[model samples]
Target: MRKVLDPFSLGMWAMILLVITITATLGVWFNTERRNSNPDRRQSFWQTKNPQRRRKSAYVRLALDSFLQKGNFFCGASVEHDPNANLASKILAFGFGFFILITVSAYVANLAAFLTRSEFQSVTTVNEAIRKGYTLCAHPVVENELRSQLPNAKFFFHENGKEFIGMLKDYDDKKCEALVIGWEDTSTDIDFLSMLCERSLVFTDSVLAEISMGFPIRPSLSAGFSYWMYYGQKFEDINIPNLKEKYSPTEALDSQCVIQLSELSLQSADEYAMITVQNMYFPLVFFAVCALIGIILQCIYAFSSNRRSLIGRVSQLDLTTTGTTARKDRFLMRRRSRMKSRDGTQDDGRFRDSRIEATEE
Candidate 1:
């Protein structure tokens, strides 16, 4: 069972990630500045001077939260914004908003078909698989052609392709990574068709080899034309290789895996599904990393603010004590000076009295 977000493609999810990242990063620039029109304080958003990390991170969280539709993206973190930055941020928000709106509306309106299940992001072509060093499995009968087509891939061989497909569960195991088999449409058995539609196996249109019906056509046929050149019974137009719908009725094919894959594809075309969290691994992880950074910076800022306040309080106490001590010392000096002067005057008076008595005698 797919989750809520499986409807959106990986690329869509990637776009969402890109938008959020840009929004968050740009939001930080707008949020951290002091909102002064003074060009020195406000220039480009990329200014390198006193970039307050904690404040910006808080804004980062808000900017991302806006995409989650919690707040207005254009003005979420901006209580007051610098003129230039405010304009730029609004423009960015509008641009992202437009992109997401169009994409989301198209899906919601059913203009585009939503995926029924989460598709694994693996190699789309045999060439791509070869380049990525994938091990390919094939029957020994077609081993030569496969080797030629996939010149570089590692190979695992089994006598019967059906046995291998059954044993390895449609080439999903690590031992035999992938399989390449061939059969004629006229002789395509029910069992063979069922194997091709295994829910575990995804079909890519990449053709390693196409065995021509060996029936030659006239000179009207051009060279380098693929087997898709074969026309339908009427031969009115080129045929599309959509085999699933053509063979949707598989009553004889009682394979649970095949039935499930077929049913899922059919139902997904008409059903409404939300994107799953599993499909959104990248963006979520990115958000998590940003939030963590914000938290760390916040802690650092709190500690620094506390330390500054503490130092200021200690300095204030010192200043008050110093002033009080100076006043006390000045008062003591003035009292001592007055006492010395008074004592001198008294001594002189005593001296004059003694002199006067002696002269009288």
Candidate 2:
């Protein structure tokens, strides 16, 4: 592994970030939801002392819903109050959606690259080859440097680089898993023959050392060798397959597994690909599971909405009943008081008339 990711993949990272964004988005959304529902303005305190809020949330359900669609099902709503919170939520939701889109596109690209990568050999570095415990061949001079640089790695030293070439020819031996040589090593036909026929062999990316060379030759010979002293060509084009033809055109090259793969491809090309239940079993099952989750979330939301509606209706009904009862009680009390005052006035007049009659007698 080049460098291990703390979390497995980009998709997982996106999910983690999206969850946090949705949590905040839902908070604002619920507030705006209640604000829009109420005819009058109200306040809710998040403090510990006054924890009872006018509107509440099903936090776990909101988290699941947020994981699916930026909490659009759970949080996207019209706002009547606190425009700033609503605006922030909208920004977060848009960014959340865009981030998911980018991540999914990247995954598709990676899949395409993976399909094409099978044609090429996996590149390795000097450290990686040593770590893999493959025998590496180099000149004796670089031996001490390599040992000091990578104390744990073992190596093979070949002075003339022929023994290394001989080991490569003995494919069964598998002695020279890698080679470390200079550019001048391939200055002649014999020098280039070491790797000329080795199809899959490659040089690792690690550079052990660098050396400047000056090949001495006569002026007449130097006229033919302008760039490289003798051959004029130091190295061929990066396309290694052409090297086989460039060196030995008459010789038949190995097909490796290309012929076998082609036969296999042709065998399957004519067969009608079937879409049996088995082919779609897992995918359909996954879709059904998702549908079930959506149904459950919707049901939870609906039940919560209906319960709040019922509570509001019941509260209004109680208030109306209480007000009507209070009005009726006040009316009866006033009527009784008026009757008592009128009876007292009539009694006083009667008492006065009786006293006048007594005086006359």
Candidate 3:
């Protein structure tokens, strides 16, 4: 037992138990009090009278009442019938109100930001583009691979090197929706297109497939060539970033290039200006689930606590009534005994008088 109740272990277990007990007790007590309190006396949580209202004249009150009523929907805290309950309760209420205000303000700001931003809806992946029936332009070498992967897709083929530059111009001119090229081909096209067009074209970050070059040579020379090529490739990889920077266009492009390139020529700017609510589905669902759970737990706690409190109050009332009834019965019994004694005394006195009269006779 001593080993089991070591200082560290005991302290941890004690803290856990204490927290659980305190939370459960508070929850039960709060739920019970809320249930016992009259609903008619409770104001809506959002309805709050301004502090200045107390000092205002009647005329001012009448004038502002309508405005206040309308504005109360945005208020975060409401005063009860007795707002002067306690310092701690008031402080807690204020803190809660402030928290709600900050949260609501932040949400409104975020919503406004989302609304004002240019709405972008594009295929983030190759499969998504294919599924949406988007046409793709690719180099001739990988046309077969693309056709195999995207069998139903409409594809335009371009030769390697400078010839592939036209595909980028075509895509920008709204001839094709996307350019599906290998990672190497994409790098090359970006370099070439960057020189030809003032606007730099950005490709999908997804790499469809990798292509490798093979050489046919005598076995004797193949080993030496393969070894040299391996080192040469590593050297080229190191300088690839420098090469890209050297070939990159002198003119800068705005961030809207991708959206501008993808949009159809016939489509209006208003179509792209439309709002797209992004990244809200999961969080909204999560918050709704949490709120529902809280309501359910609150209801269960209130019902249980209210029933318990009612039973307790009834038992107390019964005890008090029983005690009062017992005292009343005792008092009545004492009164009756005293009256009997007085009547007995009177009868004795009458009998004595009669005896005295007989003796005199």
TM-score of each: 0.33, 0.37, 0.41
Estimate every model's Cα lDDT from 0 to 1: 0.54, 0.48, 0.49
Residue 167, model 3: lDDT of 69
Candidate rank order under lDDT: 1, 3, 2
Model 2 stretches astray by more than 4 angstroms:
1-31, 34-103, 114-133, 138-167, 187-199, 205-361
- After TM-score superposition, what is the CA distance of residue 230 in candidate 2 from its true location, in Å? 18
| lDDT by residue (tens digit), candidate 3, 1-361 | 3322321234434432332333233322232233233344222211224534433364344335423432342243332223433333333234333433543454454444444544336666778887998878777777777777768788877653645666676677776787774445444443454443354334445667666766789989998987776776687653555677677533343333332233332243433222222323333344335434544656676687679978877577888998887677666655655786777855466655654554443
Candidate 3: misplaced stretches above 4 Å?
A: 1-85, 158-162, 186-201, 214-225, 228-361
What RMSD does each model have against the real structure?
16.7, 15.9, 18.1
- Compared with the true structure, the alpha-carbon lDDT of candidate 1 equals 0.54
lDDT of 2: 0.48
Q: Is candidate 1 or 2 superior in lDDT?
A: 1
Highest-lDDT candidate: 1
How high a TM-score does candidate 2 get? 0.37
Residue range 1-361, candidate 2, lDDT tens digits? 3112221244554443544454444543444333333243222332224445434454444445444444343233322223533333444444444443444444444444334333334335777777788777666767777777777776777655555455455433565676665533542334344344444453333677665555588988876666553232346343334454466532333433221223334443433222233433443344345434544544566577789988877577888998887677666655655786777855456544654443343
Best-performing candidate as measured by TM-score: 3
lDDT of 1 by residue, 1-361 (tens): 2343456656766756665665555555434432454555223343455556336664555566544542344224322233554444545444445544544554455433443335556665788778888777766766788777767788887754455455345365565666665534412356655655653554555678765455466656654344446544236553444554465555566545443334555555556444544644554455445545544554565577679878877677888997887676666655655676777845456655654544343
